[model samples]
Target: MIDYTSPIQTTFELQRRSLEQSQQALEQSVDIGQQISESLLAGLDSQEQFQRRLVELNRDTVASALDAIESLPGADVAVDDLRENIDDGYERLLDGHEEAFDNISAELEDGTDSYDDLTAELLETVEEQLDLLVEAHEELEAQSVEAVDELAGQVEELQDQAEDVQAQIEQVSEDAARAVEA
Candidate 1:
């Protein structure tokens, strides 16, 4: 008996692997963007204008990443449900940052000696967040790059196998035609 399931099974397996790899790559890219934002924020020296701009850019990037993930072909479920959480988190974080900036501005206008302390605290917080962001960004960048390379190799392999199979089929068909004419 012919093993009729082999070819279809192989094709399905390839497709499934491709999908998994693609999803992983997408997630990794988002993580890298988040990290970059954090690192950039950390480097700022407590300048109010700098902080405000960083916050805006980070929030926008996070929102865009969430949107991309949400629109994936098979994003119905996730390991951490990160897609849903990310958008809301970015929005809240941005709002909080803005509010903090406003408070700092008010303090500056009130001729209080508290601006130094407040700036110090804000700088510390930014530093901590930036450290985390940098780490996450590096890790994600490696993962995404590896995943993409692996997926490309797998696709090339699958294409070669398909072409081989096609050639065999054509050769068999030609032989059959020759035999029929004899």
Candidate 2:
């Protein structure tokens, strides 16, 4: 006969191990999900700010270029008028950049504030529920202890009653024996 059963068993075992490994990996991912969320939220505002800073650096580079142009040796053209227009344009561009950065910062601050508020509210609710759960558990434990103690006391009373009844029966039997002899 072919060893089909042995191969099937081996295949099943391999599949079982594979499933267990996958389950463990999934469990580990679930465990870290919260940490990942927290980390991303923590970085959210800062990441945007960093990007804004990098973008603003272009302002400095542009200013340096204008400064070099202003320092250029006497040109054949009307440098003052040319410089004036360039400076005006630079001023407008700088204002726009500053305004944009300010607006973005304010928005980020508002968003982060709201996010923090919501997270805090969520945490408070969870904590309250946990406290209630603990209180309920404690009450249940106390009730259980009381019930067990009451049951034990009843059992002891029943045992004492049984022994008393047994003693009475022995006494009655002795009395009967004495009566018969008399």
lDDT (tens digit, per residue) of candidate 1 on 1-182:
23434554555456556655665565566556556544544443257667678877886887677677767777747613775577677678778877886775555444333433454465566556655765665566556656666776777888899999999999999999999999
The TM-score, computed over Cα atoms with residue i paired to residue i, of candidate 2 is 0.49
Model 1 lDDT vs. the true structure?
A: 0.64
Candidate 2, residue 60: how far the Cα is off, in Å? 7.7
For model 2, the run of ten residues with the poorest summed lDDT: 1-10
The local distance difference test score of each candidate is 0.64, 0.65
**Model 1: number of backbone collisions:** 0
lDDT of 2: 0.65
- Candidate 1 at residue 75, lDDT? 70
RMSD of each: 30.2, 15.2
- Model 2, 13-125: lDDT tens digits are 56556655665565565446555555665576567567557655765676567567767777425556766776687678667866776776677667656666776676566
* lDDT, model 1, position 88: 72
Model 2 misplaced stretches (Cα beyond 4 Å): 1-76, 161-182
